[model samples]
Target: MPAPQRSNPAYRAIARLVRPVMMLVTRRDWHGAEHLPRDGGFIAVANHMTNVDPLTFAHFLYDNGVAPKVLAKSSLFAVPVLGRLLRASGQIPVFRNSARAGESLVAAEAALADGECVAVFPEGTFTGDPDLWPMLAKTGVARLALTTRAPVVPIAQWGPQDLLGRYGKVPRLVPPKRITVVAGPPVDLTDLYGRPLDAVTLRTATDRIMGAVTRQLAAIRGEEPPATPWDPRRAGRA
Candidate 1:
């Protein structure tokens, strides 16, 4: 099911503000857009490879008729004009490692309750996987999925790294890159929907969602995932 072109005035405003800039930066190929539910709130989960993936991904969702409300770092909301834009766009903030950390989920639930589309980066950060495949993810996705019992939609994207790979501090800015966004069928979590949100249940659901995202990514790359994903902690990235 595809969503309307714009769910609200805010989204329309954001689109007008961003579309032109992004159009000049890259080309896009979005597939499986029909998988998005036309109505009702649902969760969209995906791998995070670069800072700009959200911008590219948002274009895919918005064009597909789903207005996406993504959970972003709280600090972004503290910026001057950027903050106002985010709020106007109806974006949610995630306060990591602080007393307010849990607030993001609460806010997300409210968005879902309102029948809006919510997007999540279950891995919590860009892939630490050396090869850029998704790494072991946090269980927040499972908790949210079980809490709202909303559709868990997964998207796989590639090529953003070509423009802005992992904290390079600048986009390539020369050759325009083509970013690919592919939507996978919503993950099946019905078995765990009515169950307890226990640690085990959350972890299981997280894995299932990550698995679906990884598979879609693999399809886009035309390659298989490594048997063992890279771990920044184990690799001493810290």
Candidate 2:
């Protein structure tokens, strides 16, 4: 097995504090660590089910030898202690729907070039699917993968929602939930690599990435996803 990446002091400190709490509140059933790239930078994409899943996802990657630099929402970097820790730990902030929105992409690209693991939730937020399956995702991940020519690893996780419901104010930690996280092989975007970054191309690439994630989630849940992934924008129009 590949050795775990060496994290910065701030990240290590934050992980030391968070990992124990996670262990106390959750049982981990992680698989497919072998699929993660042992040395080079890669984009780790996962389905977002609840607010807490990011922590579980990070735990899985960190435990498996990758120190993930997640692209988080800009608002998260504004909180008090959490904000300071996030900045200190080198987490990237995403300014959504603003002129600064593209900044996160640039940072992520640079991180990838430096051979760091960059984690992204392409759906951009928790899945709006009533069934908690992955929804249609934004194409930012596609852009990054193509631009950097980095491998895109698809991860699917189940059980974080049980510990903390999608919109719940309180966590259900009476009996620690079992968090099952599995990684699939790097998404096959080789054919689309040299293509132009147009709308159709981006959407095509995004669909393949999300499909891989949904398939992994389906295997974990032993259930089938919808024929058409839910689209928040389309639902809003209705």
Candidate 3:
């Protein structure tokens, strides 16, 4: 299958213009971006702290010359203008609630099999973690990586919570605040694919991947490790 391609001169131009604004406001820093493959199908697994998470991921990838096919929630495409903009930018819509969730899987599989990069938030939704730490993730990512032999790139982000505090989950027309983004080494799940998709195996693999993401988050924040399986309400304490 040929890699999916989306062309939107208008959206690309807008994204290019917005990159500077994002950089100026967030004063962001990126590390280990070289870990991202220049050409191949890989899964970009990231923590979901705020609505801007996707934008941060997209900006970094685009800046690095990789146009990722983002798996976004279908609801985000409801608005007329915003929806159009997202579609123009090559984002794939996944209907999480409907029976159509398989639709996204099909699309993602095809994209990866075609040697394209696809980004997924394993949490499926915001963790609502008071400190913006990652929560237990879903198994789709594991399934995808295992089945397709695609590399899983775990990205840890901090400081978006500050942006959340400034904007309170609402977009601010004003300038941006400080945000930090970090990319970790890609995870290889080649050994896990051949096994049966049993519950125990799936959870074990997901926990392993989440653990890596947690470590990256700790590195970025310079904080002690939050309790395993990161609980936001109790400060990730057991």
Candidate 4:
């Protein structure tokens, strides 16, 4: 099967601009690449470590086989040049807390139906966990994965947060960071995929997806994940 290609000129343009720059400062070690389907639709769900990781994650996905279309915060699409790049590159902007947030899902469904890989960061934003562990995730990822019946592939990424802090900081490039992205087999949502999209099912499926990613991280981080994943509300971190 052929690798997924981008037809959007803006995507092509960004690829020309960013790919070379990325290769210069990042060394990629990707595992379980076989889990990435060569063709068709699927949702690649990953933990949020650093905002910059998305760029490199996109690079990893594009290099392996598929081009990822992500659901990003609306604010990102309102910026000047960067916004234009995001929009022109076929990204879906999410209008939050208004009447239009639902449109992001609609756009993502359309992309998935069209055989595109839709990448979702279930943690929604950067993990508030001080240790950089993934916090409790949003359920939209489960909804999207089940609604479209697409494989919910779990991937864990490490090393990007070291290079870039949540708030803008001088990025460290010397000694070029080793960014490792590992993909585990798709989370076993088959039992829950066709079930009613009730809160229980959605939450359960979301946990499984997060669990898979955590497992991957545990293996890579050489540590044990918390017995219960960090919950912002319970921990008063919300």
Best by lDDT: 2
Candidate 3 deviant stretches above 4 angstroms: 1-11, 171-176, 230-238
Model 1, stretches more than 4 Å misplaced? 1-6, 236-238
Model 2 TM-score (2 dp): 0.96
lDDT of 4 by residue, 1-238 (tens): 2335744678777877888878888888888889997667889988887779788778778888777898889999989999999988899888878899799999999999999889889888888777778899999988998898888889999888877877656888777788889998877788886689999999999999998998898898999877777777777333
lDDT (Cα, 0-100) at 233 in candidate 3: 49
Candidate 2 displacement at residue 217 in angstroms: 0.5
Sort by lDDT, best first.
2, 1, 4, 3
Worst 10 residues of 4 by lDDT: 1-10
Listed per model in order, the count of residue pairs whose N, CA or C atoms clash below 3 Å is 1, 0, 0, 0
Cα RMSD for candidates in order? 2.5, 1.9, 3.9, 2.1
List model 1 lDDT by residue over 1-238, tens digit each. 3335546677677788787788888888779998998778999988999898888888888877778999888899999988998888789999999999999999999999989899999888888877789888889889998998999999999999998988788888567889899998999999997888888999889889988988999999999898655566676222
Error of 1 at 135 (Å): 0.8
RMSD in angstroms, candidate 3?
Answer: 3.9
TM-score of each: 0.94, 0.96, 0.87, 0.94
Query: Which of 2 and 4 is the better model by lDDT?
Result: 2
Residue 5, model 1: Cα distance from true site in angstroms: 5.7
Clashing pairs in 3: none
Query: Which residue pairs overlap in candidate 2's backbone?
Result: none
lDDT of 2 at 146: 91
| Candidate 2 lDDT, 116-165, residue by residue in tens | 99999999999888899898899999999999999999999999999999
Q: Return the TM-score for candidate 1, rounded to 2 decimals.
A: 0.94
Whole-model lDDT, model 1: 0.86
Which candidate has the top score in TM-score?
Answer: 2
